[model samples]
Target: MVLHDALSEDHVEELAQLLALIRRGSAVTRSELVQSSGFGRTAIARRLDHLMALGLIAESEPLPSTGGRMPRGVYFRADAGRLLVAELGATSIAAGICDLDCRVLSSREEAWDIAAGPESTLARLEALLSELLRDHQAKVWGIGVGLPGPIEFATGRPVSPPIMPGWDRYPVRERLAKRFSAPVWVDNDVNVLALGELRAGVGRAHSDLIYIKIGTGIGAGIVSGGRLHRGAQGCAGDIGHVAVTDDQAVVCRCGNIGCLEAVAGGAALARRATAWAREGRSGYLQQRLTEGGDLTAATIAAGAAAGDTGCVELLAAAARQIGDSLATFVNFFNPSIVIIGGGVAQAGNAFLASIRQRVYSRSLPLATRDLQIVLSSLGDIGGLIGAAHMVVDEILSPKVLSLWIKEGTPEALAGAHAGN
Candidate 1:
């Protein structure tokens, strides 16, 4: 979409803000848009016209009123643009195409490992997006990716991630930019998962939150003042390697001894469940293992829910260890919400209860007093949704929005497509 040439920088900013307000569902009515944004009727009308020209904002059903005339409600156009996202996990990857409002239009999950390295994995991921985009012909606005590794957010490069061997410092942003015309954002998988929760899940009402992911690895995503707090090196929440046990025998994938992930992650829990099955410690688990030959955290959770003693104990132990670390974080970050999600977190309420039990007991009274711990509402799709949202918010920043107004055009977008 080509923007008008006569728009001043301030007006362009106002237009972006107006579009954002409409998208957020915060100011839908004309009076609310004027009162909430402090923009006069004429300016608001002109900006709204610009957004409509961009095929962004649309008129919805009129809102009911107590007085004579009903006000027409405005909302973001779901077909305005498309965002492509990939959440790369340890043993699988999720690919999705979403509208500008961050709603998943179509998504598919496939069994693919990050150990396959960046080149091959990203190629496959882009192919998936291409397949989904075959029918959806909306303009590409952005691309966001969530990797199961520490990411240098500004550069979108991995940094010596333990599990991702060939991904260290790989040029993810550069490579993806070359593959697509839109801007690309890469971040830690857990961080984007927290973003997804903050906008759409249990954390939606709470700005300060800590999202703990317990899948193939154990990590924390810290959000303070409603934004992701990636520390100086983008390693703020790399808690998987935080030592929790003094047992030197427990070696982690990172070669560290007694790391939290070594004892409390999904793979770790699965190993223990396998041992129990082999020893015939839990009849339910043993019966399943006898047929399937292997166990996962999901099966262990199912076993525990079915009254299996060994499975129950194993999950409790993992949760307790993770909880010990979170207690320390609670005292420091003092987040209002603590969200537990990921494949292992599927262990259900019993698992979350175990963590909450240990954390509340270990943390200071004030920190634990009002803390609300809950499971994820978005489940496996949170990362993809959040990644798409992140890019939208990123592009909406004043300076970036102004740049898009200046340089963004259909011909330029076509050039980016060919260049990529």
Candidate 2:
């Protein structure tokens, strides 16, 4: 029998409630736990002791009471172990270490250019992981990688991604597992960003949200009822390939024409900026660009910030186009929130204001009420933490929990405690 199935239904329900309470802020008293979890006192105590014996939870002495009997409490240890998050992007690879609360403890970045393909990227990731693990004494719980394309969750392989060439069948999970000797998970980078936003960033206060990432490429990740929807083929959020225009003029990376990404990706924006600059059509981007310095999302963000009318106009247009694409989503999903992230989102309020105006004005009025259009609060850290959350989810699973028990990693204890 699976370790998860070993627990009774009542035990599972109590455990789920315990995790939710601990995740909110671990310092729950027994009385409060009973109220929040709706479990009998004996049952809660029994489960707590089981988790404690697993080295997953520890109890604290009674607290000072205002006018009543002091109650003993339990709390999750934030630094019991470590979670590693590596974000693999088209232009750079960023890695971060997060504790139980999902706060970034340490992070580092290196540019290797995703165009270099899987081997070079994997090598860079290994180097970064070594450097990060070398300085810390904590045992790692799991490793989560955020890749540039839709992924197969079971195998951790990208499947026929448009922009990411030569990576369609990359064995990311197996390769990472061999290096780390721990469970590893790979997911679409934007999906991880959406997860980050949903749990710790802008989408925290709202469920039924859509997270759109506009960067080197365009994609969306959807969360409904606080759960990610990856679809049957893990391509539920592959909005970049949606045929927005019927022109058939420019070919997309997927061999399709008039796809949204082909028309509005960062490469498209950079090419337009370069042409305008060459023609002396705008001095704004010219002033922002340094000799031999590549045009980047930061440069574009800086251009818009510097009051470059052309850059601002281009951003607004991109926002309108994105908004147009999202209108269809609004009609279908009617989400309560929409979060925009990725390099381009660094444009901040200027970009957010435009997208908000377009989405609200163009979409249906009934759907617009209580709808939130916001930028990612996680900033560049979204991908990393989202990756970590993926590992955490698996670690929280019953079968994985049993494996974690056998491994005796400190993070497994922390997770079990959160469940209790």
Candidate 3:
């Protein structure tokens, strides 16, 4: 099939749909495309040929013959381009280069504080990405970033992030775009984690689920009907600031009283443990403080593991608080699965058991009956994988594809999408 210089809207849509089908492994053969897309054999052939001509997809080995001729398998050409992805946490950064399918090819992770401000933080991210991209030969098609704060999705700017000081209204996408010359997409870190789970982790089996990240702070990412629900102002899952208690003494970093983060977040657990250690409540914690000079959520977990009643009580209390907050969401959203992740969640099975127990006890019977509460399967790499998927999803969408398919590359579309 000869490729046309100018594609009609219908042609573009069909081509995008066909490519998406193959990319997702939903329709890997010409016959499957016809059945799935309601397009004739000839139309599917033309679109597949066009995609191959553009180096976006390729024909693979023939499938087993059902009756007569064997069918050739079609698949997205993942090596056709590369995607740069970075998942920034409150105190660390994970950056990687991924193929078109969002599989990480190479990655680097290190401790880095978000409080270092946008300039410093992004510079480190760019440096790390550059290092990872240094040896790869594939052309970078786009960039995806996950930040530990609320991001204005349209502009890819930080929106008064409580933990990310000096990042308010920062032009994240524009800066990264200028540095890398690629279209950039930014989202909340938790949202990217949820995306990672949906694409490559435990949530892959369920379309409706919630991912809760408990680290320096707490937040959630909601997926409904296989779509991420960011809600109005792109802060739908900002459950950290929801008042979980009426205790005026408990203050959150966001200046909110009795916020869930103040009661059940990593910092809160660490604070309580440290105070207990200083007050001689736990001999293990006190010894740990004497040796390390400070305590953290990990210290509390360790103490609990060592059979310290104080640490056990502290973790249980925090877990119950988190579970109570999660119960409300479970009752309202009724997700099929709830994924617990982040640094604090690494406290092991006991912490997860406590959370599961509380959630099941507090939630509605119908909602809890079928819900599965589990820990993150991807661990620290979930954000990186999720960020990669974010870029791939956006760049391959029909609307964005229509803008760049004619050019055979997204280079020109980069500036337009980056708000340059």
Q: Name the candidate that leads on TM-score.
A: 3
| TM-score to true structure, per model | 0.92, 0.90, 0.97
RMSD of each: 2.6, 4.3, 1.4
lDDT per residue for candidate 1 within 85-143, as digits (tens), equals 98999999899999877999899899998899988998999899888888687778888
Residue-wise lDDT of candidate 2 within 1-420, one digit each (tens)?
122335655555556457557657643887888888777788778767666655556787888888878877887666666777899888889987777566778889977687688887888888888888877757777788988888987778999866677788888777776666566778888888899888878888887999998888898999988888888988888898888888866677778888887777777677777766666665777754537556665676688888888788777777777888888888789999988887777776888888788788888899998888877788888888888888777776564565455444634343322222
Distance (Å) between predicted and true CA of 199, model 1? 0.5
> Residues 1-420, candidate 3, lDDT per residue (tens digit)?
356646888888888888888988998988889999999998787788889888999889989886899989998899999999999999899999999888999999999999999888999999999998997977889999999899988889889999998999999888888888889999999999999999999999999999999999999999999989998899889999999889989999999899999988998988888889899999988898889766888888888898999999899999999998999999999999999998889888899999999999999999998899999999999999999999888888888888888788876677776676
Steric clash pairs (candidate 2): none
Clash numbers, per candidate: 1, 0, 0
| Comparing 1 and 2 on lDDT, the stronger one | 1
Enumerate residue pairs that collide in model 1.
178-420
TM-score of 3: 0.97
Residue 100 miss distance in model 3 (angstroms): 0.8
Q: By TM-score, rank the candidates, best first.
A: 3, 1, 2
Best by lDDT: 3
